[model samples]
Target: MGTTSDQTAQHEGSKAAMGGLIVCPVDLDRPGLRVLDSGTGDGYWLQDLLGTYPRLVDGTLVGTDVTAAKFPKHGAPQPISLQIQSITQPWPSEWKHSFDLVHQRLVLGACGSFPHATAVRNLAELVKPGGWIQLIEPDQTCGIQDGPAMRDFIKLVTWVFERMGGHARYAYDVKRWLLDAGVVDVEERSVPNYLGARVPDADLARRTARWTADAMMPLLKYTEGHDGPIPIPREDLQTLVPRLHEELLERGGFYPLRVIYGRVPLAKE
Candidate 1:
């Protein structure tokens, strides 16, 4: 249960890891561009997008999540329409084929409860013909440059993911899912998301460490309650924060995130 600010910081690290706010080749300068960020925890991505491409102010920018409690309700530099929408469920009929871009990230938990392919199809249907859909998900099966502690942590994560009914490496099949949903020209890119030590930017690394801890602590609680097989001793779960600090501060590791995007086919003339 990461707080809104913590989630926002995690997304900032994600953006930095990906190298920018956008990875697709879509032109933001296009007039009347309508963008949708599904599972927008706090609308930070929408805010960043508007800041990066000021012209979008004239267009529609919408952010949707299952809840709106975290949405920026005041002092937003740009206008953003926030909605309570679940990507795993049906969307409003009026939204079909309406957006120039549909973006979703870190919805692996939702995927646990719903068919991921169905979710992909739902997102694909929202895109205008020739528009794009982008998905960013962590490759939880393993980490990049993982030290002993990180490797053990990944095992715990994989265990939790399986318990939730989702594949630990679900990201690897996203391209196929998009293709099955009739999207074309699909492309996938990956980058290492650093959480601690070794990051050239000290402040960002520290922020990422806090974000990671916040995001995982709740899961660790769940693990602590369960009486099943686990990667580490059940009692040791209480000391996760300090262990994470040492792992991140001493030998730093990174998780890999995959960015996948594809375009909807235009209607035949």
Candidate 2:
């Protein structure tokens, strides 16, 4: 049991179907595939799907992350026979309706547009008739309508997200965007982050540690990357970690997350 960064989201078995470790075979066993991986962090899953997937090595996989250089730093070496492509545009026009599967994850919006839903519409257009689109996302500052952390856990980052025209509340309502984009038979599944998942798995425990460290590192020093304002001070956020950890440990944070997806079942030309 070893830990890998961003390998299948830090959700332990939360992303059981997409997470790293190859605990199970990730083969989609479908035909005529042209996959577009949005937000492909360090190429973890893509590498896994190609090398160990046992079912998709022959299909074409186009990988994209927030940036072209977001490839993962470590993994059990990937396959030699997979197609990889970089995407930097808000959306790709040339690849419309050309894929059997379209995927996006952990995206930050740029402009006021609903990238969450816009991406869905774009991916929908990219999928050949009867294809599928999958999206996964988690918000670090998850809050309920009246939760203790909604506005005061550390500080207000809501304005920060708005400053850059991004959606701070995207996670809770993202699936709405997918449905409006003509994606029928939508299915939404929620996977919360439980400190319990780490209770016995040394690997997951380690990953949890790193994630906590990274979040508390006052990552605000790099606020320039976010746009403006550090939102809550790094010191403030760091201070909350111990309490947050303790609370989650008491019953695992079960942070709300959404994995919403849909299928285009009608055949298209």
User: Which residue pairs overlap in candidate 1's backbone?
Assistant: none
lDDT of 2 by residue, 1-269 (tens): 12355333353545543444222112367654566766565555566556545566666776655453444344324332222343324455678878777776655343244454565566677766677777776554553432342233324445545655565667666567767777766777665544323335656644554454345334343353554456665565555556444443343333445677777657552
List model 1 lDDT by residue over 1-269, tens digit each.
Answer: 23335456677778888889889988898889999999887778888899899889989998899987876666344567888998777999999999999999888556675888888899999999989999999887556567766776777778887888887788999999999999999999887777777567787677666666656686787786787788777766667766776778776778889899999999982
What's the lDDT for all of these models?
A: 0.81, 0.53
Please, what is the TM-score per model?
Answer: 0.92, 0.69
Candidate achieving the largest lDDT: 1
Q: Model 1 reaches what TM-score against the true structure?
A: 0.92
Cα shift from native, residue 195, model 1 (Å):
2.0
Which residue window of length 10 is worst by lDDT in model 1? 1-10
CA lDDT of 196 in candidate 1? 75
